[model samples]
Target: MRTVRYSNREELEGINSRPFLANHLRTEVAVHLHSNAEPSHNARGARVIVQPGRPADARLAQSVLCSMKELIHSVSVYADFTVAPAPHTGNKGENREAKMPSIIVETAFHTNPDDARALQDPVFRTASMKGVEKGYRLFSEGKDCVPLKAEPIDGIHLSAGGSQQVDVAFEGNPQYPIELVTTNVGCPPGWTCTDGRVRIETPDTKPSQLTLRCENAGSAPMFWNTQVVDDDGVKSPPVRHWVQCIRGPGGAVASPGVPAGVEAATAG
Candidate 1:
């Protein structure tokens, strides 16, 4: 299933369902993506769909559940094979016929408002992708889950005519090299965002920094969105930071020591 779903096809059968999923069992670990619905429209969070007796698939589900839980606290994972008719199983032909480990990721419920909102958010979507990718990596590569984090800054009240420094450090496991891409978010004109720049890429090393210059005259808040992009082109969610800039008249700057409520959050 390369896309979300095929509307032209029937529920239980489809003409494009060729090449046979069982034929690719040795080469591909089938992972189906789906969204749920309920009459109450209150079902929320995430759920995992996996057939019983598959230990590796269960592990994959758990990893995804845990990683996503870091962003969405209520996310859940469970084995679902409770179907109808004579089978009475929780899974279907996609995973049931495969010889290798397979799972279905119920990302979120479409019926719920909160889940729908989260589904539309780029940040949340990226996090879910990272969780799924990391889940597979944990099961297949046995690699460590790279803890991607960035520092927040505040009190960037700089002088109206002088330039102020803006630096952010990206830290995580060095084994998994990452490239942090930062872009300006709602930065005003004449108020140079890192000197009229938009995108900055972090070096492929641990504790990399994005050095920016808050130059020119401005009296507005500055926001930036940074994403951790891996070598494989997979990006973690987004880590956002904002600094209230008030270019005072006397050309004097205040050293923003420790932000008020600044905390680090993981990027996709």
Candidate 2:
């Protein structure tokens, strides 16, 4: 095997050198190993970053994540997507520009003392290599890497006529994006749903579906049920969420202009 290295701060100059290595030598896949930093000092876990919608890349990422999870035994790990968009541009330059399917392996958070210690262990790195091996085997044979499913995620609250974001958890390799459809028949006027698909950037994270809005509040609570459809045309059982505009201290529905203190209260 041949090894190539990038100079420090090469990215600062807009230089992506990893592609040159792959072009010069015939390679199957490229793996970029790295780490992440969280705002919270206690955040911990390992996640693989891959190009979205690429089955082989996704499988490889899932494999690394599952393997690392077993090795750490304590920290949670999952596969994440490296989507091409602003801020992230989907992923690091190495993965996006490579000649072959590529992914970035975020070992763990250095800010977390526990993870920092884990990063120093030779066994930890070994586990990562093993994970890649496992994924490579499946990817080569066109095996199923991740199971498919749609998971309703935490709901966001909004005042009547206001908008809020809805999201879902996705699993498995999908040839298409996850579609969200409102199943509630009583969705009142001003009720509109947009951005009907789950936009995922990584694994172990929820994908935003769309904004839910209502034109007005009712004397009673309003209900909404959503159907999540996966890439293979598989549909998840309807998931429910709701919102009520509070009129006063009690749980009564309020008029459009009533002040919603919303104390210790959550709206679906």
Candidate 3:
């Protein structure tokens, strides 16, 4: 068994250092440990124990587990709560496969508020060596391993058309840049705004509509502002526009534009 501890900041850096350790345990250690043990009695195989502190740590653990699954397809997992590890042991006793050489990790310390406070700490430089040592010991003894899934992010809605600007808010790993592109509906493909902000031309022939797309250039969520301007160099009015991408089924989602006369001639 192999045990690993992860920090929120380091995991966010896009490094999967723990998976390598898990691979080492499974191929290098588990094969040998199982081969020497008798087959009639249940023999516990090696496992990977991960101790995650914050929500990000859990996510990183899931990523590491996913990578490990790709390499060692038959590894079992169990999550031992730091607060009550004893209760979970009984639950695992019912399943024989779970009795394999597993790794136990202290993902978090509820007693220490400082560890929990690290979630909001801007300078995430501290390391939880205690958790690491415990996990390593559990993995060495083949005690407890658990599987976990990553959490999802909140959705965003953006609308920019008919001389109206839109702003979209995104929260996630901030290392990535947000790229926004705007294109007019039923217009020439060449007619588009590559910049984050978009300015729409109220077509003389018909009411023109444009779509704004926001995407992350890297592995993090990004945020940007959208501004619309008219040919007269005046700021456009705040119009309620439906974000097509977020809208469901029917195309009835529309941003009713105020009459041209109602808008002030001056820039908003």
Model 3 residue runs over 4 Å out of place are 1-60, 63-162, 183-268
Q: Which pairs clash in the backbone of model 3?
A: 52-107, 77-145, 77-146, 78-145, 78-146, 102-142, 102-143, 102-144, 103-144
Top model number, TM-score? 1
Give the local distance difference test score of model 2: 0.52
Against the true structure, what is each candidate's TM-score? 0.46, 0.42, 0.19
Scored against the true structure, residue 131 in model 2 reaches a CA lDDT of 50
The lDDT per prediction is 0.52, 0.52, 0.27
Query: Mind giving the per-residue lDDT tens digits that candidate 3 earns over 61-157?
Result: 3333332322122111111112222212212211212212332323333234543443233322112222233233334444443422112212235
Candidate 1's clash total is 10
Clashing pairs in 2: 79-203, 80-202, 80-203, 81-202, 83-90, 247-254
Residue lDDT tens for model 1, 150-199: 65544344444333445556544222445556666656544434312223
Least well predicted 10-residue stretch by lDDT in candidate 3: 28-37
RMSD of 2: 15.7
* Candidate 1 segments whose C-alpha is farther than 4 A from its true place: 1-9, 14-19, 71-89, 143-268
| Regions more than 4 Å wrong, model 2 | 1-9, 12-15, 71-89, 145-268
